[model samples]
Target: MEFTTALFYVFAAILILAATQVITARNPVHSALFLVLAFFTASGIWMLLKAEFLAIVLVLVYVGAVMVLFLFVVMMLDIDLDKLRAGFWSHFPLALTVGVVVVLEMSAVLWRGFLTVGRQIHGDSGNIGDTKNLGLVIFTHYQLAFEVAAAILLLAIVAAVALTLRRRKDSKYVDPAQAVKVQSKDRVRIVKMKAESDRVTLAATEKQGN
Candidate 1:
């Protein structure tokens, strides 16, 4: 077997194992860590496939950003493992069935290209060329789909923020508009004390005459 082929198989095996562990691990943090490992291995596989742009993006975006965020969130949550596992056995059968179906579908899709004969089809000729081509395709043919996906992701971020931001009636919060509209003239009062000065002068004169 070629060295590249052997390395490909190794990376693929690692990715599969890590993905399985991501779902099977009892600890949420461990599962998230395994998912990060899976992303790394997948990126390696993409690199081997000559999709350098996709590979780098997979590592930078998913492994570096998304998985780190997931790890922090998992660690922060006060999760009860026992409570989580309570219905595991009850859900196992259905989950297993779904998993099998998914595996079969993936196998069928991959098997479709099994007998195809070709040299290593490099999606990206080189580092710079690949990025330019990727950007061109993304902005041209796939622009609408990309925009829709971005919109969906934006909605998800907004929903997550809304869910985490709890309203407290006792807590004082400033309204930005009201604060911006406030003026110094509305806050300070300038009162004239002309009568007080005249009264003081009259009292002083009366005292002096006495």
Candidate 2:
């Protein structure tokens, strides 16, 4: 086998193992970590296929950002494993049914498709590095779609921040809306008053006279 084929098999095997571990790990944090590993291996496989853009995106978007967010969420949340698992057996039938259906559908698709090993689409094409070409297509033909996606992501981030900063009845927190609505009259008071030094001097003069 060629070195590229051998490397592809190595990455595919690692990807499968990592994916299995992701499902089997008892701890949620460990499962998230394994998922990151799985994503990395998948990126490697994509690299072998010469999908440079997809491979880099799989690693950067999934492993760097999404998995970190998943780990953060899983770690920050209070989860009762035992209580959560209590309904597992009861739900097993439904889960298994869904799983089996998905598996059957995937298997049927695979059966219909012919498998060819050692065949690459690029096949040593000088333009194997299609990252620049992909970018041009995206920014030129799909510019509107790309802009919309970015807008959606920005809105999601803003919404997340708003939700996180929302007021809670039990917490001692200031309402930003109320604060913003406040006039200078509500926030400040102007009073005529003598200086402390003047007040002290007047008091001392009165005492000496007495």
Against the hidden reference, what TM-scores do the models get? Answer: 0.70, 0.68
Tens-place lDDT per residue, model 1, 106-132, is: 998778778554444333543432777
lDDT agreement of model 2 with the native:
0.86
User: How much is 42 displaced in model 2, in angstroms?
Assistant: 0.9
lDDT of 2 by residue, 22-124 (tens): 8888899999998998998888888887788888888889989999999999999999999988998999999999999999999987866656534454323
